[model samples]
Structure formats: structure tokens, C-alpha cells
Target: MSIRSGLFKLLGLCLLAGVLVAGIMFPVVGAAGVISNQASETVESMSSSLADEPPPLVTTLTDREGKPFATLYEQYRIPTTSDQISEAMKWAIISVEDRRFYDHHGVDWKGTLRAAISNSSGGDMQGASTLTQQYVKNYLINVTYRGDELGQQKAQEASLARKLKEARIAIQLETKMTKEEILTGYLNVVEFSRQIYGVGAAAQAYFGTTAAELNVPQSALLAAMVNNPAVLDPWNNPEKAKERRNFVLDKMVENRKLAKEDAEKFKEEPLGVLPGGPDKPASTCVSADPAFGFFCQYVEDHLVEDLGMDKDDLYTGGYVIRTTMDRKATLEAKKAAEEEVRKDEPNVANTLSVIKPGKDSHEVVALVANKDYGTDSAAGQTVYGLPYEVFNVTGAGSSFKIFTAAAAMEQKKYGIFDTVPVPNFHVSPVFNWGGEHCPTRPSGVRTYCVSNASDGADTSMSLQDALAKSPNTTFVILEEETGMGPVVEMASKLGLRKTMASRPADGRQPDPDHEKPEYSMSQKEFYGPNELAPNGRGMFTLGASPVSGLELANVAATIMSGGVWCSPTPVLEVNDRAGKPFPVKEPECEQVVPEELANTLAVGLSKDTQPGGTAASAAAAAGWDRPMIGKTGTTQFQGSAAFVGATPQLAAAAMVFRPDIPYGGLSYGGPGNVHATANGNMFGGMTPAQTWFRAMKPIMADLPPEPLPQPDPAYTKMR
Candidate 1:
């Protein structure tokens, strides 16, 4: 023999001796409770343990009616059974990866010996790993290094130790599983491409076909990609991919799985990879359909925040989530908001929320916004949902007057019939206490002006009539007499503050004196203590507090239910992979006000929908024959228009505003324009009332009608 050949032989013998010594020294406990010095024995222990543990599966999300709307996954993989895999795919993989797969035990001693000889002689090193060993390596990499970049690198390090461990594990795996079972498991767990795993996902991603439908050429291409996915990506590197595919085809023919003529024919054929990108599955609410995106996000938030579920499990644990979304109601709400709001005025936004009213009413039937529920790059807006009750909060305008009325009756200080002077404008002592805007005149009395929308002549009207007219002067006088403490408490008792800022103790509105250079703070911050101190403001009763649309809806629902407030819930049920039921929260009901007082307030507020009421036009537009109670509200300079209405069966709230424009008293103009009002000013009775009417008309059309509870005789007697 030549000197180089002799040296290589000696080196190979030394390496074999070293491997034997290591195996004897590292004897491991094997199956059947037997201790063995064989290298396979150590592998048996580790492989069995690893094979029993699998990675987390994908989670599913469904709507109320059990229709799947979205899916969440870390790696988009759907496992397939052996029977579902094509024979072409199976032969293609086995021929290229392990021609002797069924002929040998997992270790492949002959191949290993040949590889050792070639490597020692400095010849082109050949891989001796069998299919089982490759599977073992992949399994180890996934279990040990998932979500860790550095750990994955280390697990894939081309070292003697890693190879030895893989060999041992492969040998043991062969003992536990049949060849077909191992092949199926291997195909299910292997990574195909970026964010894509398993043969099922790969087949669909590459050809838009299932595993069982993959033809011979397609199967050969996929099998070739297994060796070097990045380099052999058919779409990116067609030349290298074609070469690899032809190699796999030749191997199949060499192994007698395919005829020589067929192999040659496939080689001449074009790499007919269909034109498409990877099939990346939706993993979050942002990727959901526009109609369901907002509701999906709400459900995800509830799962993570309220229920304290792990976010990782939410994306991967395969838990089935079912939400309380009524598809028809949700679509109608969206349609109403979109149709009622002027599409030409891109700046204008409208939001609507609907909820059932009863002790067991926990589901938020519909929550819709005018804007699409995703990023609007052209408009420079990230969040697309309106100021929803739980996520975003904003001003409610005169819609809050119902709370003031509830407080008055709850305190027994004033009944719904209590009279107050309705004037075009009025001034108060507390208004002059804070600023120089209300200076003392020659009469020696400081005056704060409060104006009504109608600019009507001085007249005294019952509290019920004042509420229907939404006169600022009357509510201010009533608030002064009843005190702001009771009004704030009444709002809290309902669900106004549940998802928003609690009422400040001092009851102060934004101060005009401490003017900041930037006026970009949210409407909630303007009414919150951030911009204002805790002292009573004259305009407190005129709906200065910021509230969410859902908050207003919940308040209306509470009144509809005659005092009982049911905390809003979004999800109805959750299930595991095996369809086993999981615990779901029930509606939490509390009596926040007396039934008599609630009924009295509901009856008084219903006057707003009367022929002469502020929202009369909206009621006329809705054209409903059922009994309905509602209130209209408009903020200072018409910054926001709002309406809260309810029937005995359902309650809803709608609001229209321009969030992009700061709350510096900008008015929402009439149809087709946002900065200019055709009627000279925007009111709750215009856009918001119209939105509420259109949305509620369809939603309540099919529901059974129930009469509003009659006011207490004692309270009605005072009128």
C-alpha cells in the first residue's frame, strides 16, 4: 500500500477504537430495564423520551355559530397520515435520503465504515446518516433550540458528539416504531421552508395541492429541497433546484423505484413549479378579515388580559376559541356606520356598539367602526377601531345627561318632573371662581354663560322636557342644585367607568389658564385630571366627561334591564384539541340603582324620541313602531355627536367624531364634509342619531318587543 493509504487506514482504526471505548464508558439504561454497553443502548433512552413529547399545535378561532374565522400558529404545520401521503413522494424521499432504509437497522454500519474510510483519506466526505438519524437530529434541534437563535446554532454544530448521539437515538427509534410510522412522523416534523413545516403544509405551499395529490416531478422537487432548502428553493434558484431534482430522479431509477425511461423523461421536463408565494397563515387579529378583525382582537385581549392566559399558548396551544359575535348583527352595524357616515369626508369616523339587555346578557352582539379594521397607510392611522368601550375611550357629550337625571331621582332631591329654567344662556357662581372669563359686571355679580343649541327665550320646563330638548342651561341649574357628587356616583354605578377613567373627586374640567404648547392629548385626557384640577366646573352636567361607546351602551343596557348591570363579556366558550369544554366566565350582574328610579329615568329619557324631541328626526328616520328610549348629546362647538338608545330587549350607542383633528372645539360639518357644517353646527340628532337609528332598526327588527317599564306612581304623581 502507498504511504498515504497506510496512514489513512491506521487513522480509521484509531477512530473506531475510540468510539468503542466511549460507548463502553457511557453505557446507558435501555428498554426492558436492561443496562447495555452498546452505543445504541444510550440512544434508546434519549430517543424514546424525545419521541413521546411533541411541539405545540396550532390554535383555532371561531365565531359564535362555530364557523372558523381565523387560525393562530407559530409554525404553519398540519400533520398528515401515512395513507394520505403519495407513493411518489414516499419513494422520492427514500431514494434520495436513504436508499437502504428498509434493508438496514437505524445505524447503517456499512455506510458509516465507508464514510470513515473516505473522510480519513481526505476524499470528498460522504454523509453516512440514515433517515432515522436525520429525523433524530431534527427532533433534537426543535425540542432544544426552538425560539432560541444561539441554541439552534449549537444544536446543528457539525461535531462528533452530535453525530454519535443521533446515531444512538436512531438505532433505538427503529426498535420502537415501524418504518412507515417513522417515515410519517419524520415528514410531519421536518421544516420545509420559512415559517412552513410538515409535508402537508409544504405540498399546499408549493403547488396549492395536498400531499396525496403531488405528482412525481413535484415530489422529486420537494425531496431535493430537504437537503438544502435555502440553496434548492425552486422559486429562487431554479438552476440549482433543477439539478438537485434530476439527481433525486436518477436515484429513484437507480433504486428501481422508477424506470430508467421515466427518469430520463422527467429530467427533460421543465421544473413546473406553480407561480405563488409561501402560504403564511394568519397568526393574529391584524391578519383577520376586516369584518371580524376588531372582534377578534377583543377576544384575544380578553384571553390574555382578563383570563390571564399565556400569550404563547394563545398562539400555539391549539385551544379552540369561540366568541359571542352575531354575524348578521355585526355586519349590519358595520353597514350602518359606513353608510350613515359621509365617505367623501375621510376624516370623519363613526362607531356603533350593540348589546342585549338582561340579567344573563354578557355577550357584546356587535361592535363596528366605519374605518376598515387594519392599518390605513394613506390616512396615517395605525388603529382602525373606534373608541371602543374596552380599548379606547372618548367624550359622550349630552348623552351623559341620563346619568345626571338618574342621580337626581336616586338622591330624592328632584323627580323627573322637577322644573328648571331653560334659557339661551345662563351663568353660575362656581364658573367665576376659577377664571377671569366670568368677570363681575356693574350688577356686582359674576356670571358664567351656559347656552342651549336652540338659543331659546327664557322659559321654565320640566326636567323630562329639558332632557328631551338637551338644553345646557337646564342641566347646569339642576347639577348645581343636586351637586356633582351624585352625578359621578350614578355614572359609576352603571358601567360608564368600567373601561374608562373614574370620575375625579374634585369635578373639574380642563383649565384654560394652564395652556400647553401642544394640544394633542386625547379627549379622555382633556376631561381627566391631567389637564384639569379636581374642582367643580359649571359645564360638568353638560356631558364633559369622556366615555367609551361600549360604556355608553352598557349604561343604556343597564337602564333597559331596570337597574341590573351585566358586565360585558366577548367570549362564549373555549375548547381543547379533543373538543373537551373549558371553563368560561358567566355574566356578572349587580343592582346599581332601584328599579323604580331606573324605570323613571328610562321613561323620562324616552321623550327624546318624541315628535318634538331633540332626536325626533332620527326616530322618524328609523321608522320603528316599537317602544324605544334614547338621548342625544353634542359636545362644545360640536366636537363629538353621540346618541344612546335602548329597547327592552337590546341597547346600542353610536358616536361621530374626527380623531385626527384635535379636540379644540372643531365641528363635524353636514354630509360630504367634516370641517364645515351645512346646518351651521353638528348635533347628536344628525349623524350619530342617524347612525344609531339605521343600525338599531335592522338589529331589532326580528327580536320580540317588550314595553318599557312604567315609572313609579309616586314619581309620576310629582309630575
Candidate 2:
């Protein structure tokens, strides 16, 4: 109990006091640091949400008469608002993931509070981070949640400092931008599925259209993506996606975002994924012919370049392109072709490809044998949508006439009536059917003998009569008269290119980087100097090269109608950002061929269908019952049958299908499958002609009938 004892005790008390004060200050400073870090990171993360990357423009296509056949869209990119965002899609994200998006800034204080309470309640997991904060961690902040099974959730939870940062950003965003902007930013950043990030992209991935174009069902389906993008991708997950979709609909109904009628309609609608995965690659078109699809894609590619516009701007930028198409003539040609398809013979397949003179736009109406569109193995397997954005077909057979005749006429080798004298015995350096020789016949005598290839002999006929009958001997002589070089040049002028995508020959392995290179050696063959495509050769006229049905139709259209090949037009007018539509400039048509020559050739070809002509059967189907104009050619691969004609107020062509029935194989098609139509007797005159008739009936009904033009008397034949 001395003074020393007292001093030591006091010193101990003082040391204890200092330790307690330091502990209090340490916690306060750490809390302050947490708050400051949170505030700074908040705005940076939200910035990534609304950033816009220029999307590829959609390439819209039109028919021969400048009507939209299909809408080629990229991003299905519709500039949408929160209101425009389907209630279904929005709910899918909110209910399953973050429910307080509307109530909070980028940071969810209430959610965090609830999560803290849940932790106190002894829950295994906790969630309070807002969608904006999550988006920031996933995108702008470099995706930190990618560790354990629940690593993302835990990592996201651990980012309160990150949450605080996003929260600060959300407040700034709300003040600097708008609710709509915030929503758009959120939508653009939200990952819905494989490689799909924005709502606009999601719309196309699910519905094959834009966000604005999505129906309730499609929207609901798309909304489900936010729940578990990879898991509930709708296309990959049916039941889960449906359940998720239904959940959204129920929420919307509960929230009154959609009427009961609309909700019910959506519930009843089917959910089907596009055959080609979500975002359609550029140049993809659903066509009756993949070959034809390639052509459509090619034209679209050139269109963007020729028009000098960004694809995104060209299609969605809302610009209108005008074309040079004669709807009247296009309909007529389409009708004539389908009339032949109606017969539906096993050997004879039918289709009509048409284009206006000088117009890049074209009309392609094909009469497919089946509606499946998936495979050709089935007996009645036909293609579904002619106007779909992705389709391809191998143009075969009688279609060769377009190039053959074009070559002959363009090179001035033969006039419409020039008597080229169908040879009875046409043996030449060219490889004929079965590698025999050209001019099937040895004698050069003149007679309208359709196809003497079987007899290895031929008769002679005038050029007009030969073309009308599609006689092999007649054309063989013409090929001789017109060298391959000039013939190829004329074919190009007619818009025919020789490279194709598959099946070798015309269908070779297509280069993914370049669209026009179907054939490996194409660039060396024809096209311009160092271009990808084959020039015409003596053997090239017999459908050896690849041309689309639509291209063929365009070629015939140029000739049948007074040669007006103007640029194709899909939209009638371009609209400004304000929704005001302005008419686009109309294109001009060119005189690709002499009107008199087109008329004369058309006149003479009519006779081929009259009797024993190659396409005579096709002609008979159009109510002619006997005489008409057409051309038919059979390949080792497939049969070629077509009938191109010009009636009063209508000028068109049609071809039919010969599904599975091979030539030079077991079924030769002589006894039955002559025209590849529905029935054995189906020919160009049958099914295609009948389909043509049916289509023409309605189109021509509204217009006054125009007289058929007379052929030029001075024109000579190629007999």
C-alpha cells in the first residue's frame, strides 16, 4: 500500500483506456472506406449497359414488281422502350433474378436489407445486388463471379463495394438519362442466351424478327431467357422455357401489362425455334432452292454495295429501294410455270423465276412437290416459303434454254427466225449425252426434231421452231454457230452466274468468307477479269452451270417484257427517326434485248408445245391441250422442263419437279415421270402450267387484257 503501488495501478488503467479508443476509431474508418469504394464503382458498371455497337443492317428483298418478299433483319434490332419491352420477358428476369429493379437504383438497398435479414434468419444463401450491379460485375467489371458453383452469387454478394459503386451510378444515370434509357441500357446488356446480349437481339433469336415485331408469345418466350439464359434458352429448353414463359405471363396478367385475350393467345401459340440458329448470319435466305437462295443473297450483297449504304442502315435505317418489275408480266410468267407443276409428275418438277428488264428485283414462285422443306427423300417433300430469308435450290434442266438462247441471240449468231437447221447427225468436239457427241444426229438435215439424243441422230429445224420445241440438235448447231466466249458474256448480261454452293459442279464447297465463290475454278472460267464464275462453253448451255430459278425467271422476264432490268426495290419509302415516310427514288429500266426479238422468239416457242416438242406436255397443261410453246431437257442428274410464254396482259414461265426420280438411272421417265409433276403425265404443260394458270387467274383478273405483241417479220429462224 505505498505510493509506487498506486502509480503502477494508475498506469495500467491508462493503457486499457488507450486500447479501447483505438478499437472504436478503426471500425469507423473501415466502414467509411467500404462506402467510398461502393460509390466509385457504381457508375462505371452501369455505363456498359446502354452502350450501342452498330448492328449489321437487315437486307430486305422484293419481288420483280418491287414488293417485299422477305425482311432480312440483323439484331431484329428494334429501338424499344421499357413500355415496349414485353411484360413477359421483363418479369422472367425480375421474378427469377432481381425483383427490385424498378424500386431501386443500380444498387438494391431493400434487397440487401432483406438478404441481411435472411442471413440472420440462418439461410444458406443471400442475394441483394441489383441487376445493374450484376451486369457491371459480369461485363464492365470483368466478370468476377466465375469461380465456384455458387461463386458468381457469392462473388456478386461480396461486391457491396461494387454494389455501392453501381448504386451511385444508377442515381447518376437516372438524373443524366431517362427511365427509358436506363431500361434500354439494361436490356442491351442483359445476357439472354448463347451470344445473345440485348433484348433487341433476343427478339430475333426467338422470333426471327425485331423487338417491336415480337408478339406476346414471342416476347414471353424471350423474357424467359433472363432467368437462366443458357438453361432456358427456349430453343434449347422447351419445358423449362414454357414454364418460365408462363410464369412471366401470369405476372403480366397479375400486373395488368397484358389483356387476358393476349395472354391466352400467347399461351396457346406454339414455340418453335428457327431451323438456322438464333441470329441469322448475313446472306442467309430461306428459299425453295439453296442455289436460288445463294443468288438472292448475292443480289442483296451487291445491293448494299451498289446503293452505298450500311446494311444496318439500308435495312433498318429505313431506306426504300425501287425496282424495275412488271407485276403483270411476272404474274403471267408465274402462272404459266405453276400450271405445269399442278400435274405433279414424279419426273417433272416445276418453278418460275422472273425478273423485269434492267431491274435487279425478281419474282420466284415455285410449285414444290412437298411442304416439308427439310428433306427431298420423302415422296411428297416440298419446300415451304419462297419468301423466307434463307433458302437455296439447284436450278436444273430446261432453265438452260435461257442461257443457250441468250448466248445465241446475244452474239448475233442467230435471230429469232434464223434457220440454223436442226441437224439429223450432230457430232462435234463437245461431249453429248453419255459422252457420245454433240448434235445427236449425223445428218444436218432440217426438221423440228425435239431430242434425237436417244437415236444418236437428228433432223434439222429453224431456230424459232427448234427453240420452241427445245430440240437438242437445233441448239447444238446454234452452240456451234455462237462460240462459248460470246455465249458466256451474254449469260452474264442476263444476270446468270455459274458458281454454286454445294453438290460439286455448280455446287462446290462454298467459301465462308466470300459469297460468290461456289466453284473453286470459277474465277478462272468466266465472270469479269479474275472473278468467281464460269463463262459459257459449248457444254455449258445444257444446265452445266448454276443459275437460280429466280435468276432464270429474271432472264426470261427481261426478254418477255420489253427489257427493263432496274434495281430491285423492297420498301416503298424510307422513314425518318420521327416516323415520317419519304418516297425513295424509282430506278430506270434498260433495253437488255430488242422487244421485237423477244416477241418473235416467244411466238415461235409457242409451237413447240403444239405436238412432239420437248416441253409439249407442259404446254398442253395450260388448256392448250396440245400445241403451245415450251422446252424440255433431261440431264443425267435431273430432268429440265419449262414453258415461257406471253399471253395478252401476261408473260411468264414455269417449271415442275421430278422428285427422287433419277434419269440415266432405273426410272428413265419416258413411260411415266415425263414432267415431274403430281401425276405421271405431269409436264410443263401439266402441273407447272396448271399452277401458273391458277396463280395467273387471280392476278390478271383485276387488269384489262393487253394484246400479245407480234414478232418482227424480218427476224430469221435458226432451222
Candidate 3:
């Protein structure tokens, strides 16, 4: 024999002796890390981790109706208990993988000795790992060294030292866990196919059944695949998989786990796997329905940011998340949005959000966008969370007028019926025009002047009438009359907190010429004590800042709920793997404004869909006769348009803007020319209000119309 061969055999005998000692002494000396220096730390550290750490499992997200729509996972695994596994599955795996599983403590010493001698002789290297040893190895690879490629390789390396390390950990595991638990853990953490892990997920993927329901033949096939999942995959190598499966069945019979006659009969049966292939369930927001994908992404962000959940745990914690998404409502809203602004309309995007209003909770029911939620930008699909986020949409336009009106009423200085001047154009005395070329006053100050949407609004009218017409000059004048601070504060209080606090990264860079670059900040910061545009400016009332469509809908919800501001939450419920209720962390509902002020504001805004109102034409077209309050907003340059409305039950906001042109405005007659003119057709009342009425008409069809609260005479009448 060669010297190398002699040395290998001698080393193998030494390892065999070490393993024998470890098998007997591991329970006592194992705690002291007396195993070899190379393996002591690895075995000791990994043993406790195996006992303490649970394997990565799948997390499912369901709609409000409790139908699962999306799944999130690091490893596509579903954990099952010993009782949840079938007897056939346990026996088949043990019979083929380790025939003397129950007879040995953890390591089968006789098999190990034989494998050691054979391997040392340079024949086909064999694995003598018991189920517990395999469990420890799998746990180390999947859980302990999940992302560490080097650590995974070390756990799987083919060496006597590695085997000794595994043996020591396995013996320790046997003392801590039962045989059934070890079997279950091994079955769960083992890979059955690409991205498919665990017996539970395997059963569902292979046979469209649960682990507990797996029959003998099905269990045998899965057990056989654990040896070589890629090669033994039934979909690709059916003949080989069948042959391996039959071998497992024969071994089961030899072990007396299955009857010989039953094994023979089962061998003739075909692999009854689910049709087409393994039923690998699609995961992540990208795989969700186009109509609901945006909302699914929104819920994911909300869970991490507001609920304080660890992002990694969210994917592997096996949580069952029940969200407030009304699938039907979401589908309908998406259909309406796409119908109004076709999904193929590349530049423009129409976004909508719906909230169920309440004093304690404002449940977000729907978030829909005209564009399909996906990564294929060329196909008119977007991955941006448009409905819930500000994104590239310019501003909410005259939507800010709602806050101004609310602020005015809250101050008790101006009532809804109190007359406010409406002129063809008005010059502001308090605000600077900045870079805009405005007419210089006699004092050489550039006057900030603004005009109404149309050329024929030179008359004084009540605040309620002015809101319906949405005269730009009136709201800007009102913002000056009512301090800008209160108006900005009202927007924050009425559910625009996130919108006002968002510091968009684009266009915030400091001047290149400046010695110190000033970073761009959020609207709230601009209105605060910051040196950049402190205390806000004149255009605040006209909604000249980017805003969240979801929060705008929540603004209507806040008003509909009589001044209570509740953070809009998508999660309805969450349960841990143990099926215990997980508490959701959300901002508490607070009364931001007086109940009477909100009620009075709602009554005044109710005229928006009435005769001669801006949204009157759209409301009439939709046959909208329900008792509702609404407001329409069109940006100064027609960059974006928005409509916010609410009933007693539901509140919604819809906006239309050019997503591609963040710093630019949407012209009526722009490229793609679906429906545009130089300055004729793009107004909040046109597309956005039409979209709102089109969606809300069907949503509110079955609900009874509830009347608004009586308007407070103090806000309705002049002080």
C-alpha cells in the first residue's frame, strides 16, 4: 500500500476513536468544550443555536376577506410539528437515510466506522450521519450561516473533522430534543427542490396537500428527493425519481415500517404530483395582482416603519398578516383609474386611495394607480408606490384650499358663508414672487400676483361658494388673511403629516456656487424655523407642494370622522407562528380640530357636487345624488389635478399628473395626446373628479346615504 493510503487509514481509526468517546462523553464533557480545539467552539456554539433558533419559515399576506394573496420568505419553508407530519413521511425518510435511527443515540457508530474505513481506503465516500446529525448540519447551514457562504461551506465540508464536529453537536441535540422533534426539524430544514424547503412546503408544492395528509407513495418520493433534490426532481427526471422512490419504499418494508405487499402495490402507482410541475407559490409584491401590488408594497413598508418590526424577521418569521385591503374595492378602483387614464398612457398616471373613516381607526381599503405595478417600465408598468407615496407627482393643487378653509373656520375669524373677494387677478402684499417676473410696485418690490382658473370670476362670494369654484386668488388671499402657520398646521393635523414631513431628495441640492451646500428639506421644515422658506409662503393654500394621495384621502377621513385624526393603517391583524395575536403599533387617534369645526367644514364642502359647482358636471354624469362633501384642485400650471371627497362611510382622494415630469407641469396638449389641449381640458374637476365619481358611484351603491352634521352657526355666519 502507498504511504498516503496507510496514513489515511490510521487517521480514520483515530477519528473513529474520538467519535466513540464523544458519543459517550458528549453529555458531560461536551458542556466544557473538551471535544478537539478545532471543533469545540463550532459544536458548542451551534448546539445551543440549533435548540434556540427556529428555521426560516414563510409569511403570508391576506386581503381583508382573509384570502391569501402574497407570500414573503427568505427560504420558502413552512414549519410543521411532529403531529402535523404523517407517520409514512417519518418512517420513509428514516428507513432510507438511517435504518438504525431509533436504535442509536444520535450517531450510528457501526455505520460511521464502516464509512470511515471505506473513505480512508479512497472508495466511494459515504455519509453515516444520523437524522439528528443531519438536522444539526442543516440548521447550521440554513439558520446559523444563512448568508455567510464560507460558513455554509465549512458546515458541509467532506472531512473527518467536520463529521466529528457534527457528531458531537448531534449527541448534544439528542439530549435536548426528542426523536420526533429531531425528525421534524431535519425534514423541515432539508431542501426538497430549488427554493423549496421543508416537508410541509414540499407536500404542498409536489402533491398539493399538507404534510399530515401525505400518503405512502407521496411521502416516499419526497423522502427519496432529500438525498439529491436537484437530480431526483420528479419533474425533470421522472424515471430516476420513480426508481429512487421505489427503493425508499422497499427500505421502508425491510424496516417493518410498511408492509411488503403494500410496498409492492405502491410501486406500481405513478408519481401523482400536481399537474404541470411543482406548485411553487409566487412571492413578494412583484408577484401580487397588478391592482393590489402597490397596496401590498405599502403594507410592507408600514409594517417595518410604524410597527417597528425587524425587516429580516418580516420575511422569515412565518407571520400571517391580515391587511385592511378590500380586494373588491381595490379592483374596482383600479379599473376606474385605468379606464379614465389608460394604463398605456406613458407620461400620465392617475392614482387613487380609499379609507374607511372612523374616530379610532382609518382603515385604508384601496390604493390604486392607472399604471400596473411592476418593473417593466417600457410596458407602462411602474414599481413606484404611487398611490401611497408622493413619488414624482408635482403637487395636490387646490387640495390645500381644504386646509385653508379648515384653518379659517377653526380661527372663528372667517365663516364658510362669510364673503371673500374673487377677482380676475390679485396681487399679494405679504409674499414675494421670488424668481417669477411680477409687476414691480411703486416701492420697487416685485408683487406676487395670481389669477383665477377662468377669466370670468370677478365677484365676491361666500367661502363655501369660493371652495366649489376653487378660485386660485381667493385661497391665496385667504392664506395671507389667515396666518400661513395655522394653514400649514391644519394640513399636518388633517392626515398630511407624512406628506408634509417627506424630504424629497431631488431638487434639494444646495447651490453649486455656495461655499456650503444647503440640503433640501420637507415642506414641514420649510414652514418651521429653518432658514430656507421659514414659516411657509403664500402658495401654501394652493397646494404648491408634493403630497401623498393616501394621506389626502385620510384628510377627508379625518373630517368625516368629526376632526379625529387617525393614522391610516393597512394591517387588520397579524399572528405569529404560534397563532398568537401580534400587537400592531400605530399612532393613536387624536382630535386635531374641534368636532363642530370639522362638521361645519364638511357641510360647507358639500356644495362641491351641487349645481354650478366645479365637480357638478362629473357628478351629474355619474348620477351621483348621494349626500357627499368634495373639493377639486388644479395646479397653477396644470401640472397635477386632484379631487378629495367623502361620505359618512368612505373617504377617497384621486389625482392625475405626469409621473415622468417631476419638475415640469402637465399641459392639456402634451405628447401622447390621449386627451389634452393647450389650456382647455385638464382641471381637477375634469379627469380626477370624473375618476372619483366613476369609482365612488359603484362603491357607495349599496350603502345608505347618511346626512352630514348640522353646520355650526358660528362658522356659517360672519363674526
Using lDDT, give the best candidate's number: 3
Highest-scoring model, TM-score: 3
Candidates 2 and 3: which is better by lDDT? Answer: 3
- What TM-score would you give candidate 1 relative to the actual structure? 0.83
Predicted candidate 3 versus true structure: per-residue lDDT over 353-433, tens digit per residue: 999999989999999998998888887799888888876346778878999888888887789998988887888887766
TM-score of each: 0.83, 0.58, 0.89
What's model 1's lDDT at 283?
Answer: 69
Cα lDDT of model 2 by residue, 49-153, tens digit = 434332233444554456654445433433466766665556555554566667765556556555544544465223665665555444442223322447555
Scored by lDDT, model 1 comes in at 0.72
Residue 139's C-alpha lDDT in candidate 3? Answer: 85
Residue 656 lDDT, candidate 1, scale 0-100: 76
Candidate 3 backbone clash number: 3
RMSD per candidate (Å) reads: 5.5, 11.2, 4.0
| Candidates 1 and 3, the one with greater TM-score | 3
lDDT of each: 0.72, 0.48, 0.82
Question: For model 1, where is the 10-residue window of minimal lDDT?
Answer: 502-511
